[model samples]
Target: MKKHEGLNCDDCVEHLYTYLDGELTGETESDVRVHIEGCGDCFGHFEFERTFLRFLEARAKAQCAPEPLRRRIFKEVLLDNGSEAE
Candidate 1:
């Protein structure tokens, strides 16, 4: 792994989300990637976050509510707010 001359644990943690989401620019991404590779703790945190995002993605794909269920929820929300679902 190439060493990121100025990257450190704090910087890596600060940009973890952006890094995982592929929102970082090329240079920033490289720095964060290198930092994570050399820092065990940061790497573990990155892995955990990555796994969590994947789990959420899979769960969302698998558990989409049907149209009827969505309508029911919308009606329920309207009723809960004292507005009838006409």
Candidate 2:
């Protein structure tokens, strides 16, 4: 990917996650947005990570911990709090 005026593909990739998470300031975010719009390779990488995060979110929502695992977590929390399991 060619280097843009404000950011290159490497800089864009470095800040990709922060950009996706809306953690960047206005100017920095704009720089990343402009770079991705002009750079096909960086844009592809951004899209792939976005899609992968969505897939993981969906999978997490569809699954649940087993009863034994849940109980074990509860017990651990109680122990950490210095409380006996009832």
Candidate 3:
């Protein structure tokens, strides 16, 4: 099949995450597929996001935050910010 030359910025940015997550449907999904087939810039962005998510997952598994740290953050930030319920 022939490749597209470029995609409109809106289509590139808007559908990017959805397309990556396989959340797009119908015409929108088709549009993203067509765009990625040819647009190097957008494809690069898609690849980067995928790689980043993989890194985040691996890091979360390798070095999880301690429960005390979570509680401290909640008390210092959330409670300090007055987000507590009455």
Which regions of candidate 3 are displaced past 4 Å? Answer: 1-7, 63-86
lDDT of 2 by residue, 1-86 (tens): 53446898898899989998889997789899989999999999999999998898898898788999888877787565575534
**Cand. 2 TM to true fold:** 0.66
lDDT, model 3, position 41: 83
Q: For each of the candidates, give the backbone clash count.
A: 0, 0, 0
Per-model RMSD to reference: 6.7, 6.1, 8.1
- Native-referenced Cα lDDT, model 1: 0.85
What number of backbone clashes does candidate 1 have, counting pairs of residues 3 or more apart or in separate chains? 0
Residues 1-86, model 1: lDDT tens digits? 54447587887899999999989997888888888888899999999999999999998889667999888877777566565434
TM-score for candidate 3: 0.58
Model 1 deviation from the true structure expressed as Cα RMSD, one decimal place: 6.7
> How do all the candidates rank in terms of lDDT, highest first?
2, 1, 3
Q: Top lDDT: which candidate number?
A: 2
Tens digits of per-residue lDDT, candidate 3, 1-86, equal 53654458566778878887889997678878878777888878889998998888898889778999999999988887785545
- The TM-score of candidate 1 is 0.66
